[model samples]
Target chain A: MRNVAIIWKKEIDSYFVSPVAYLLLTMFGLIFGFFFWNAVSYFVIIGIESQMRGGGGPMSVNEYVIRPLLSNVSVVGLFFIPMITMRLFAEEKRTGTIELLATSPIRDIEVILGKWLAALTLYGCMLLFTALNFSFLFRYGNPDWKPLAVGYLGLLLQAGGLLAVGTLISTMTRNQIIAGAATFGVCLLLWVLEWVSGYETATWAVVLSYCSVITHFESFAKGVIDSKDLVFYVSLIFLGLFLTSRSMESLRWRA
Target chain B: MITVEGLTKRYARHVAVNNISFSVEKGQIVGFLGPNGAGKTTTMRILTCFLPPTAGKATVAGFDVLEQPMEVKRRIGYLPETPPVYPEMEVAEYLRFVGKLKGLSGANLGHRVDEVSNRCAVADVKHKLIGKLSKGYRQRVGLAQAIIHNPDVLILDEPTAGLDPKQINETRDLIKSLAGDHTIILSTHILPEVEQTCEQVIIISQGRVVATDSVQNLQSGTRGAETIRVEVSGRDGSIEAGAVRQKLEQVAGVSRVVLRESSPQLAVLEVESLKGKVVRGDIARAVVQAGWNLNELHTAAHTLEEIFLQLTGAQPTLEAPASGEKQ
Candidate 1:
């Protein structure tokens, strides 16, 4: 655990020293801020329309604003997660510094976890920026905070899972661009797998839909924390990191 | 100390390191001399636990590299062929990261980092980003990282490969200074470098151990079959260069004679005697008998370069293989 922290700290330092971290932050902030403005303005316009009609009670901000905003942020994250995890192992291999890591006394698990945790922390920072924007809703209206907390937890778990997979992909190649492209492709496939459910009712389609990351995030976005969803995210995270450690072991053999 | 027993590393259809074995005693600097693709780096990688041997065992500091890789890694510091440095990191920060990874912490880490930085002559650029440093400085920083924790063994793969002559000399001096405290295995194709720094050399060829010996012994052993060069001035016009060469080639004990250089006033011939024959006296007597002024006649001791070329090329021709040669 201590060795993991050392690697984690160095990785984080590497991220900030390079322009990639700032580039991802600015890009995520802009995309999420745009989504937030659109979601809030749409919520306010609908609130005004319903109030003028005088038919329904005041609209629930939880449903109208916070929920959709969280889901939209999740979608935006698919694009940024690749950027966060692209350089984790690929850059090390490209620069020949992978030799140092592999030959160090630290365990392969520590290296993988430390790098994955660094990516998750950077992703967490991007989430924090979006959360600051969501804090505006609390000043004027009483939106339930518990759902937002649960929603953020879901975002983190979902990011953790995808980032772990990205870490595995990063270890497969020394080219960061290739790692990024492959991660984006895999994330997109997972995101769109749920669409198969609309056209087919077969067991395969059900399994595909169940495998889609969106299927797991949906319950969390709606203020529900199903143990099934938690298990899915945790299992995916473990599988990804497990594959990364295996890849690291093979790298030593093949080097 | 390090030990290897029939350490072999095969990749698919080709073997990178054959069943080669050798050992290094504590506080000794052994040079791994080989051509570019002769598997020196591969062997070093295996010893450092960066790679595993395909079908053999290697132990470092009494720990098997395969079974106790972490233990071996803890005792050895490896600098690969290219300096493995993160370009985005400052020198001090990069050293700190490597030091921490080696399990040093707190004040000890700081003190060790400072010690290696100063020792490596990289302290002036400690705060400078590594990407902006020159290749010499980067190589020095790489050396600094390797010694930050003061491991028992240091595996340096061509540590002076890309440095200027001045930096190369300085680096050699620093390595020499660390001789008694650290066991170093430096690999290089440059013969003079091994002569300058390494006490013993392990000459590798085609993934096999071809020769190993102390520098002095290797040199003196090759002396038995040394080449002799003779320059003669044939009284300005008493004989043509061809006649001078013909006369010299007739000398007994001379196996092969080649005309090295020829002028109207002078001609130089290099004579190679058969193994175990000293042809110097025979050549001088023959030159004097031929009525040619023997301007110069001296036996040229076989340099490591000739021995290296002969060993690493298609032929393994050393009469007495060094003590480390397995076969």
Candidate 2:
């Protein structure tokens, strides 16, 4: 546990000391802020239209504003998560510091957990930055806080699952660009996998939708915490990290 | 302490380290000498647990490298051919991270960092980023990181490769100072470096161990024949170069005499003595009795360079580099 913390600390320090962390923060903040502005304006326009009609009840802020914004945040992550996780191992390999880590006394699991946790923490920070815009909805209108909390939990689980896959891809090459591109490709595939079920109800389509990361996240986004969804995210995280450990073992054999 | 038996590493097309075996005793400084592509780095990597051997067994500090790698890693410090450094990190920060990674903590880690930086003469650049430092300073930082934890065994590949002469001398002195406390295996192609710092040398060529012995023993054992250089001057050009070479060849115990230089007033010749013979005195007497004024006469001791070339089957006196090129 101490070894994991030590490695985690160094990785976090490296992120902050370089320009990458700041670049990622700035880009994520601006993009998410744009989505936030659009969602609120659209909600306000719809609320006024209903009031002008003088026929319908008040629009739920949770439905019109927070839910859309949260879902949009997940979409933005498709672009940003790759950036955060690309350098986890690729940069170490490129700089030759992987040699030091490989020959150190620490276990391979500790190294993987340490780096993955650091990447997750950075992603958490980006999520927190988006929450700044969401606070406006709670202050101006009455929205249930429980569902908002659930939505954020969903984001965390979803990001954790994707970041694990990103970590595995990072170990495949020493080039950060290649790692980033390959990770985005895989994440996009996972996101769009549910589209196959829209066309038909065949067994292959059902299985494909079951594998989609978005399918598991939708329940959490709707203020529900189903055990099946939770299991899917956790399982993806485990599979990704397990494969990463295996890849690390191969490095010892092929180095 | 280290031991290896039938250690081999084969790449896709070629064998890097063939079935070669050698051992280093506790507190001994051994030199790993080899030409380029001779598998010095490959062998060091295997011992350091950076890579597993394709076929064989090896142990470090009494722990089998293949079986108990974590134990082996805990007891050994390794510096690869290229100094492994993060260019963006400051020297102090980098050393601190490596110290923590090696399981040093609290005041002990801080004290050892200071100690190794001082020992390697990198304290002045501890705050500087590694990428901005000169090659010599980078090499020193690499050395400092390796010794921060002060493991039982230190494996360094081409440690003095890119340093200036002054830094090279300082590194040699520092390594010599570390002899009795740490078992070190350092690899290099420079002959004099081994003579100056290492007590024993394991010379590998063509991915095989050609010879393994102490410096003195290898030298004496390979001194099969002797060469006596004699510089003779004449009184008003009395002796011709051809006549002098002919006469020196006729001397007992002398096998071949080759004239190195011929001038009107002076001549220099190298006389090769027969196997296991001391012919310097014989050549000196022959020159004096022949009425040739002998200005200088000395038998050149066989050098490690010649021994290395002969053992590696390189040209006897190669003008090409022995092993300094990149593999």
Candidate 3:
């Protein structure tokens, strides 16, 4: 237990001590900021029609800002969450420090949990930075708090699911570059399922896509906390963490 | 104390260490001598619980390595050839982390960190990042980390391998100081290191125990060959070489006589004997009385280097590695 906390503290220290974490944070902030501004400005002046035909469009700023945020956050999240998790075990293995940790008195599960918790903590901080976008809505427009809160919950759950998938991919290799690419590939593949048409196939795909992280998060974005959605994210986290622990054990023996 | 029995480690095709076993009593500083790929590291790893033996048993401080590895790990301090250190951490912080991992906490952790730093002479570089330190200082830091918890056994693999002459001398002195309190298994290909610090030597080659005994015992083990190296000065004159050979052969246990060299003037005799007593004293007395100049008479026993070469089949003399590449 004490060793787990020691490892956790060291991992969190590694996150902030390097430039990579800050760079990713700044990039995420900029993307969120740009989309928030564009969403609000598009409908704030007069509606969308004036620029095209001098006839006003029906969508209001709330429709513009809130609609894009619900979807765009999911898209933005797909990229951001993986970047945060790419180095978890992969970089440690690459550096040979993983061997030190494994051979220590600490158990394999402790190492997996400590690192996973650190990655999740960093992702949560990244998600918090996205809240600044909603701040703009609160100040300039009268945004409905319930829907926005629900959206935030969904984003939180989605982040949890994406973080798990990212960690699983990182467990596969010692190369941080390969881990990053693999995590992105998995996230991209799942996120793209939403584009496929036909309600029957897309519905099942959407349901699976609800397992897809971004899809389940979409439900909360419109103001609902589905227990099924919560359970799916929790189960994915458990599965990912369990596989990570097993990988650590296998690698330890092999070494 | 450590006890090992039938320790055999095999890879898929070849055995790295085969049925090799030795025991170290408390306070014994045993040096492991072997050539490269002689299974020195593999055997050490097995004893340290870093690798499991294919079929055998090992116990450190009475805790079976297989059944209680954590207990073994707790009692052993290992420094691999590369010294597992974080390049980013300062020497002090790294030691502190290691101490903490080894179960030292609070003021005890601080005290141990200080103690090890001073013992290893790494106090000056305690605040310097390990990557920025020189090879010698890095080695000291590595040693510091290993001994921070004051383990009962210190397994240092070539601890002085890449050090300069000054650092090598200092590290050797440090190890010598550490001897009685900690049972140490210091491995190296360097023979004199065994002579300097270790009371007993265990030489492993090609995964087999080629030799294991005190330094003096190893030298004297090849005493069966009854050849006494004798140097005599004789010109064209009075003394018969055959007469000296015949008289020396008459000694009890003196077996056969083979005179060495084409130079008749420089008569060197190699006496083969079943040999009761060494008989060199008697032979020397007789040779002098016979009117032959007895220049020198020395009992020929194997030197440590010769024994090492003969037993392990390794080169007796290897060129010292050029300075910069030693690192």
DockQ, every prediction: 0.71, 0.70, 0.34
Best by TM-score: 2
Native-structure RMSD, model 3: 4.7
Better of 1 and 2 by TM-score: 2
The parts of candidate 1 lying over 4 Å away from their true place are B223-299, B315-327
Two-chain DockQ for model 3? 0.34
Taking the tens digit of each residue's C-alpha lDDT, what string does model 1 give over A162-204? 9999999999999999999999999999999999999999999
Candidate 2 per-residue lDDT over residues A52-116, each given as its tens digit: 88878878888888887888888788788899899999988887788889888999899999999
lDDT string, candidate 2, B227-286, tens digits:
788999886675688888988998999888889999878899988888888888888888
Order the numbered candidates by DockQ, best leading: 1, 2, 3
For residue B11, model 1's alpha carbon misses the true position, in angstroms, by 0.7
Better of 1 and 3 by TM-score: 1
Which residue runs does candidate 2 get wrong by more than 4 Å? B230-299, B315-327
Better-scoring candidate (lDDT), 1 or 3: 1
Residue A21 accuracy (lDDT) in model 3:
74
In terms of lDDT, model 3 sits at 0.77
